[model samples]
Target: MTHTILGANGTIATELIPVLKKHNVNIRLVSRTPQHVEGTESITADALDSEQLLSAILGSDVVYLTIGLVYNAKIWEEQWPVIMRNVINACKTTGAKLVFFDNIYMYGKVDGIITEETPYNYISKKGKVRAELAKMLLKEMASGNIEATIARAADFFGPRATEKSIPSVLVFEKLKAGSTAQWLINPNVPRSLNYTPDIAEALYILATNEKAFGQVWHLPTPAPLTGKEFVKLAAKHLKSSDKISVLPKWLLKIIGLLNPFMKEAYEMNYQNEFPLHLSSAKFEKAFAFKPTSYEDAVKETALWHLNR
Candidate 1:
């Protein structure tokens, strides 16, 4: 059966497409300027185009919504709703189940642990946007117009992730250059950081498992480590014991003066500057699954960096 993946070139999709192919899924990709990857089908279509989205979703058994407004806040507010509207309409029309790749921003600040049941407590614009989209999908499902499931992952980090998030420029690039790894630096705190491939696996599980629809599931995420501890682990794999450092908060604010992106980053100090943890007990018990150990995952990540 066919499964369409939106945002064809994203980090999770890069791993997801290949894994889906291994399971004999007829993988189709939707992108603005799609390029055919060998052994997969491609369709160049914007999510905002209802006609295009319908065409992309036609005859697909499952569609993965990996699409999101990437780096620009203004463009995101203007674009995401239109894109989601198209997806909802297409799925409603064609009856294809949707497996949405979602992040943790909607959960916002939690003093203890973030579980699947956590309320959407964040007041941020982006957090509210995610909360609404999720609520709409579930609401639609309740009316029997659509079948959908969501796989929630923490800050994604793995090979091919670039400058946009923590794992890329902040972690991999710094370590590769033998520098004191830079981050927001909250040692002794804990939070989950999911591997993209593991998230893909969970998404695939949701796509194929009829029992998984109409609900959201957590991805199997390894227990969180402090920023300093995580860097040390990765460095240990590379035969280095470099101490981790943080870009001073004052420095981050100064940079935010010129960079709107940094301005957004400044608000997310909770993830790295203090205690934040995401619990994955539900996914583990549901699938009898376990995440790769933090030490092992770190070693693999470091090896990827060194090999690159």
Candidate 2:
């Protein structure tokens, strides 16, 4: 078996590397500036270039689209379509199965626990982009052009997930320093989060299963936790004070004035305002595997940050 990972340095890819290798699967890790991962071949390629992407995936059995764009709505709108099209086209040319790592943004705001059946009702720049890309892949799969599966994960937190996840950059970084941790929106509202390793494992399972193709699976994850609850759990693991503060919208706006990333975050703040719960009952029922408990995940993340 052979696997080609498109964004090999990403959190999920980094975690998935070991699982794929352990299965004795030949691995090709692709990135713009590729670095060697033990026991895997590393290649430099741009995912947006169909020729380059096709070349990287030439001899692979499964191709994982784990690439991510910067946190800007305009960039997502301009780039995601082209990137998805390129990957889809490349897979078509190479005859490789695709396993897309997706998110819950397309579902938007929901009244109850989000399931795969949730209708696409929310309207946001990022949400629309995700919805469109997902639809595109499914359409291709339906037409028998490519065999593909989609694995959707929630806000992720685990080892090597430092760049964009809340647990690392927002909560643990400050709590480890004995400073108050900052969170966005209503800190009391529970939100779904997935351990990065669990997500990687779920994607791997999907890639190897023939029945999973042409379907969307919510990766197994524990119940939701509020920012306050999450920070307290981290504090318990770190043996530090569990002090947390919610950043008001006005304050975030002021901070956004100078920081482009902060400015872009404002549009997606709706997720924090409401309880965004993702249900993995279908996946768990099918695979008979449960996600890592929240406490253990927090402990592992706390240790990772402490060691860093």
Candidate 3:
């Protein structure tokens, strides 16, 4: 069996390649830049390159769509639609199963707990984009042309996940330096965080499991921690860590003026910024797998950061 993945350099893709290779020796990855990925064939191509994308899709039994876009609204709106259209067009020409790696952005506001049944009615531009894309993918799948499934993961932390998640910019980097770190938003709200390898493992299962197609699956994850406890534990693991400080909203606004990315992140502070919890029970019941205990994940992350 041959499997091909789009956005091969993405954090999830980097971890998933090994997992896919474990299932099949014939693996192919598509990226705009060329790089060596052991146990797989590499195809350097862009989603815009219709011919190349179609060529990459041909003869591939399964395709993992892990395309990534930054937090910029203007760029995300412009770029993601093009990629989605190209992917839809290519998959239409070639009958292939598509497994999409997704996040929980479309659920506008959570009441008490978030689950797979949560309706997508988000007001944010990014959230709307995600909801629309998923709808389109499912619509195509329903038409009997392309088989599709999605694995939704929470805020991720793991190897090569640097530059992306909040923990990377706030906790890991600051604790490593023994600096009194000020985290964004309310420090006492619960928030789920997924370890990278676990996410890759979950996706590997969904990609191979035929029954998972046409359903949205939440990847199993451990119970959440208040931002304070999360960072404090991380600090203890690091040994030279200082107490975590909460960066006030006003302060973040001031910092936002100088940084566009930070400004975009601030808008979504409603999450860690307040009280919200995520539930992955459906996936757990379906897969018979539970997320690793939080302590172990934190320890592994700290060790990885120390080594890096």
Candidate 4:
């Protein structure tokens, strides 16, 4: 089987390549500047260009759309729809199944645990874009135009995700540098996080299983820890101080003026103000999968940072 990954060099794709190699499947990595990996084909293509995307996906049994656009809301609003449409069209033309790596932003601020059945009630600009992309793909799936599965994850953390993982940026990196850890808004609200390795493995399982298409699956994630609990656990593993400073909304607003990332992050800060829990019960029951424990995950992440 030939499995092609779009947006190679990303945290999930980097981790997933090894899993695909273990299965001895032919792998193709596609990006504007894809790195050459042993036992895999590399294709240079821009996902936004219809011809390039279609060419990259040709002759594949499965295509994984793992592309992450720029963090700016304006960029996302302008680019996401075009990319999604291009990928869908390419997959349809190529007769390849699609596995979309997605996030929980579309679910917005759920009052309870976020499930696959959660409705799209997005609050921020980014969330609205996500909901539109998801709905577009769902419409195609419902119309029998594509064989695809949506694999959603909460904010993720693990090795190789230091730059993108919120916990890594606020807790692990800060503590490692002998500085106080930071948490957004409330430190007591529960926050769910998916370990990157687990996400990679689950994506592979979904791609290989014939029964897994045409539906949404929440990739398995362990129980959530409050921001304080998360920082404390990370501190225990790192042998550092657990003192945390919370970034209040007003402060974030002020910081947003000078920092582009902070500007985008300010609107999404609502996620941390309340209990953000994700349920992977559907996927766990279907696949009989067990997620890594929080303690083990934290220890492994801390060790990785130390070694690096």
RMSD of each: 1.4, 1.1, 1.6, 0.9
Q: Extract clashing residue pairs from model 4.
A: none
Using lDDT as the measure, the top candidate is 4
Could you estimate the TM-score for every candidate?
Answer: 0.95, 0.97, 0.95, 0.98
Error of 1 at 4 (Å): 0.4
lDDT of 2 by residue, 147-257 (tens): 999999888999888977877888888888888888887889989999998998899899998899999999988999888899889999888888888888888899999
CA lDDT of every candidate: 0.81, 0.89, 0.81, 0.93
Q: What range of 10 consecutive residues in model 2 has the weakest lDDT sum?
A: 119-128
Instruction: Count clashing residue pairs per candidate.
Output: 0, 0, 0, 0
What is the per-residue lDDT of model 1 for residues 10-75, given as tens digits with 9 covering 90 to 100? 788887987898899899989998777998999989898999889988999899999856666567
Q: In model 2, what lDDT does residue 74 have?
A: 89
lDDT, candidate 3, at 304: 85
C-alpha lDDT of candidate 2 relative to the true structure: 0.89
User: Higher-lDDT candidate among 2 and 4?
Assistant: 4
User: Which stretches in model 1 have alpha-carbon errors above 4 Å?
Assistant: none
Candidate 4: tens digits of C-alpha lDDT, residues 1-308: 99999999888999899999999999999999999999999999999999999999999999999998889999999999999999999999999999999998898989988899999999999999999999999999999999999999988999878788889999999999999999999999888999999999999999999889999999989989899998998999889999999999899999999999999988788788999999999999999999998999899999998888
Rank the candidate models, highest TM-score first. Answer: 4, 2, 1, 3
